[model samples]
Target: MCVLGYCAGRYRCPNCGRSYKNKVNLGRHMRWECNKSPAYFCHACDYKTCRKDHLKVHLISNRHLKNVAGKIRYPCLHCGKSYTMKNNLRRHQRVECGKEKSLVCYVCDRRYYYKQELDTHVKLKHNISAKIEGFPVPMHWKF
Candidate 1:
């Protein structure tokens, strides 16, 4: 099968048969985003993924956030639901987490991750420069 446009060939992905132009990219894909046969294993738990970055994500999200209850408690800010991984929490918050964001943009009511993000949005979308409180002023203030 053809992946995107590349035909299945010697450089095709082993998991999905998505062909690539060279081995370096294939190696990178296998090490980071293969849908199957993930070699990197998380010893902190049974979590395994194809990419090494995922392993680190799992550690920071699942292991580091784990508490006295021995449960990964990265809760979705929108809902009370807890997650083992922060990425999962982020996904849930963005999609099906069933929660409302507190930081709503005054211009268009768009939600954001942080208050400063909302300020930036107001400035860009509304053409109103709402400076962040206690924000470090940029140098080159010519008076």
Candidate 2:
């Protein structure tokens, strides 16, 4: 698919199929983002991110200021639900926090927070084949 706003590709990420114009940019993406779990976390909040710079921004943002007096708790600014582990809070925010699920199953009208979850639900629960139904399976889910 198109990446960086153009489709005439020179390089592509094997994990995510994002195209790039050069190997250096693709290599950088692989090293930093592609298929990589978040490596940086904010000690003050439930904020976690793949890049150190994002964690830095989160720390500087007003969200980090909500840390409870002395206890090591991470509270969601959107929902006020707390988590002890930064990763847990991050997951909660990404998967089930106050934000609406934008991805919906066409067959069942069920909603999901992530594309992978919605794709899986469409595949297994609906018994629809991606090849036959023209459902676009996520690149990471391809066998």
Best by lDDT: 2
Which lDDT value does model 2 have at 48? Answer: 73
RMSD of each: 15.0, 20.7
In model 1, how large is the Cα lDDT of residue 99? Answer: 45
Over 16-78, each residue of candidate 1 has an lDDT whose tens digit, in order, gives 766678888878877667766777886656787777777666755645457333875786544
Q: Which predicted model would earn the best TM-score?
A: 2
**TM-score of the candidate numbered 1?**
0.26
> For residue 84, what is the lDDT in candidate 1?
69
Among all windows of ten consecutive residues in candidate 1, which has the lowest summed lDDT?
134-143
Please give, for residues 1-143, the per-residue lDDT of candidate 2 as tens digits.
Answer: 66544466578676798878788888888889888888897775677778887775575444564553444667677776777678998999887887678777777788787777876788899888655767664443323
lDDT of 2 at 63: 53
